[model samples]
Target: MDACSPVLVVGALLLVLLGASAPTVSAARAFFVFGDSLVDNGNNNYLMTTARADAPPYGIDFPTHMPTGRFSNGLNIPDIISTSPACLLSHLGEYLGAEPALPYLSPYMRGENLLVGANFASAGVGILNDTGVQFVNIIRIAQQLQNFQDYQRRLAAYIGEDAARERVSQSLVLITLGGNDFVNNYYLVPFSARSQQFEIHDYVPFIISEYKKVLARLYELGARRVIVTGTGMIGCVPAELALHSLDGSCAPDLTRAADLFNPQLERMLTELNGEVGHDDVFIAANTNRVSFDFMFNPQQYGFATAKIACCGQGPYNGIGLCTPASNVCANRDVYAYWDAFHPTERANRIIVANFMHGTTDHISPMNLSTILAMDNTRN
Candidate 1:
């Protein structure tokens, strides 16, 4: 996240409509990040949190079968961003003090030493202050920024202040979260039990207010170019389907929750862009979709297996997790879901392509063209 100023807030974006020219080139390079499990490759190794991926079967698909603290079987978004040349930062001989012959969870300091950026996203984190207070000390948005500052200081020490500043300014700031906020807080545990006592409308607004603090902090901390991914149609997860007896039918309540959150989040971006007087610094990546309107009719979605996951039997039906009696699917590509909650690596790849291309219907930046046009708008 870099810095933004007052430029595109008050309809200054209308320049394109008037056949105006865009900026020359953006000055960012270091993709500093902060969020939950989706973007977290490691970094949490230093923290004593229960929501850890420093175990087996997590990185089964990764190169050399290395478990790099990612919850997935392979590289997550941060790694994808680092794939580019200039943004490519080494994960050895720096963050960990020195490269080691064997990689282990205790020495997670390896990847954090990269120049592209480090991921501070932890699993089970939420926008609200106390969503999973007892389960583990998840990194909240505020705390995530604190870590980002520390990252900045370390980078400055190693590469010098000016270079570090330029790297951060030019690089993308990727922040993916909001799933745990709804799932763990409003739906599970203390909140779920308490939700019955409160109106969902009342509860959601309270959550949004706290989320605002996170955004404000990022903008203040000089995170100019940001990709804030909004929550998707989460009600479709196998666990939720099982819990609510949904039978592959979308939980309208959950859909309503997404509807409530996405638009408000967009407006927050607009207001923040205005508040800071900058162009579209905050682009909301929409992750909600039913894959060609098929999931709505489940029959139309064309899977006889929507109700039960291809992996487990009772609840999540996911085989790959650290479950004792997991059901591993032979062919994972056919199934839309990989685990109870997340999509398959293939699905995520497609989604990332969509996130970059902005072609999918659910979460384009206003429209894909709007984003394409903004590429020319940089100055």
Candidate 2:
């Protein structure tokens, strides 16, 4: 062939055009969830505990109009993040393939279902083993991690070892912890055991250290992309306000606990990412900042009220758990909270929007959209 043949030039041009026209095909990424009730789908249904939410008014807003062990009146955070077209609404859902990951304990999560990943989150569980001790039979973070390992083994049995490991390494992982550590443990009583063990100053670091270990374990288990959400405005929740607020304001002590916890959580995540030699491995979502937007200014976010629960009784509707006998709101969509501690599905969607496309202030290092774009490029 000639060094500068017209035929060769034409062929090169054609090759470039063909390459430009070909669409990129990225593999469907698996999703893994690990946390507490905020993301729990139906894991608690299989367990015997007071933490269970499989009851009336819990899933009244869900597609089936039936409770599915989710704390919210409708779909929880995880559901909105990974649900199918039927549940799709947020941009994040578009990235997360069809169908939400099934609860690890669900009977249907076997064989081919393993490839879709699983949710290991359990209601009332926290970073520490004793955080939700009162809710006996719940899966603690330690057990959740163990279950993740078991899940990999089960997946390996179906798709061989190396392939399963690769699938996990390329998957997206989300973990929301620490909140229950304070609410259900350190501040459960006037002088709880944890509160007495260490001052708020000291307790924050201890939990952050404990949480570091959990994140490290996830990374070790081949989780390359992980979203670590900080504690939200826990003090602003109806339950806290009812218990500790004197003038219908957020409890100062609990608010201080959250302020102290979230920043430290971000710092720990930053250190973890630096240790891994990658900036995008562990993205920290400032749940407090985004949540405060709707919690403080409900009307701005289209909510009628954030102080009262749609399904509770006492002050702020924050006294007890939402049950069949509670005063249910006429319009669940207008209420920021579904019960004493959980957010309504509408509130959850707003939170997810920030996670998917918020600034560095709301999502440190980079947002979920950036992570998705980068991962897609890599794939």
Off by over 4 Å in 1: 1-28, 84-114, 190-198, 290-321, 360-379
Over the stretch 103-148, how does candidate 2's per-residue lDDT look in tens digits? 8998877765677788999999998899998998899999999999
Estimate the TM-score for candidate 2.
0.91
Local accuracy of candidate 1 as per-residue lDDT tens digits, 6-102:
2332122233123234231122244566777777766565568777676655565554355657766555655554342211123111211111111
- Residue 57 C-alpha lDDT in model 2: 81
Where does candidate 2 clash, by residue pair?
none
User: TM-score of every model?
Assistant: 0.76, 0.91
Candidate 2 stretches greater than 4 Å from native:
1-26, 85-92
For model 1, the local distance difference test gives: 0.58
